[model samples]
Target: MTAPVAHAPVPLQLKRGGGDAFIVEHSEEFVTLASTAPSPPGSTVEATHQGDAGPTTVRVKVRGCRRDPLPDGREGFRIDGRFVSLTRADRAALFGSQSEADPGSTSET
Candidate 1:
């Protein structure tokens, strides 16, 4: 079986506004995102990481977006995107590492 690529579900900066999303799943070519807010299609997403090492960025392009009902009876967004670029530090933050043993340490979906 192929091991899942380590993806850090960190907060992202939206073109118009900021919501939240998990790097729900990923591959070498793309990363799928699930957000708590709607992301406009054709927008660019940015994930920034800061630590002892410094800051880095993970950029993705929004391919599509949709709203889904949450279990709490609230609404959320499912944003599917493709990775445009990912720095090494960005990778470590998404996947687990000694620096960030728990990658997706951000807010819950």
Candidate 2:
């Protein structure tokens, strides 16, 4: 009898307008983060693979600034979402710790 093979998890990278960054790791899933403005509100962002598909909508509301203050008393941004898919490089950066492994480490689809 033949055995089934296991695949590694995927990694995600999110970049907001203000240079904010997010990293997510999952097997097969999607994520979305959306938020409203606060007079001069910013934006919400989510990162995903090129061809993967699924729900891609998120809604959020801006509350107040950060309690501890950020540099110039700027409040931190927040998002709500989930993981969808990750590219091979994203996977390595997240799971493999950016290590250089055998090219065959990743399975062919």
Candidate 3:
């Protein structure tokens, strides 16, 4: 398995009641979302990202929770969680596309 690669941060949205959304900074295996209140430890949250193919949802477990003060002078909680079940194809789409062959590898015909 390859190490987690760094990609540009994207906002992930979780559908909530009354047309509300939970925005999060999402990566391949991890996501961070802001909230006015902190969730209980070891809670499960689902984040969904809609791509050209379809909507990819990942089950995230809240492992680390803390209070964060935003630069805009907003106070809230930050939820840090890891993707519980991220598939290979979804990983490629979310993080980045992984090349099948190594570009640095040299081969003899």
Candidate 4:
């Protein structure tokens, strides 16, 4: 299976009743993040990432959360989640205007 695309440790905002997080990696199916708060499994969280067109927002289902080290060597929470839903436009906004053949478009659920 292909691996998730690693992203720069850019801060991602969790809009509406959430905390900040940093993107660790992502694929069409899943996104991993580092945050200061724990998200219980089966919960949904909305996160926004800046793109070329504008800010792309997505809701993810929390699969797991564990203690981990952040990029800056501090203790943090590592969050694993799957995309709750995505549309054609959302895909474009998240990974640019690239085709599905691109590595960023791995799997979608």
Write the residue-wise lDDT of candidate 2 on 15-71 in tens digits.
343232222212233322222212122433444322244322222222221223222
lDDT of 4 by residue, 1-96 (tens): 457978567566788666677877887688888886778898887888777678878787999999988777777789898877777788666655
Question: Which has the higher lDDT value, candidate number 2 or candidate number 3?
Answer: 3
From the highest lDDT down, the ranking of the candidates is 4, 1, 3, 2
lDDT of 4: 0.77
Q: Which residue pairs of candidate 1 clash?
A: 7-94, 8-94
- What TM-score would every model get versus the actual structure? 0.59, 0.28, 0.59, 0.72
Query: Which lDDT tens digits does candidate 3 get at residues 1-109?
Result: 3443333444445543211124456654666666555656798766676777777775678878888753234686677877788888876555555443235545555
Model 3 stretches astray by more than 4 angstroms: 1-6, 16-37, 69-76, 99-109
State, as a TM-score between 0 and 1, how close model 3 is to the true structure: 0.59
Question: 64, model 4: CA deviation in Å?
Answer: 0.7
| Candidate 4 off by > 4 Å | 16-18, 99-109
Cα lDDT computed for each candidate against the true fold: 0.62, 0.32, 0.60, 0.77
RMSD to true structure for each model, in Å: 8.1, 11.4, 5.3, 4.4
Q: Regarding TM-score, does 2 or 3 come out ahead? A: 3
RMSD of 3: 5.3
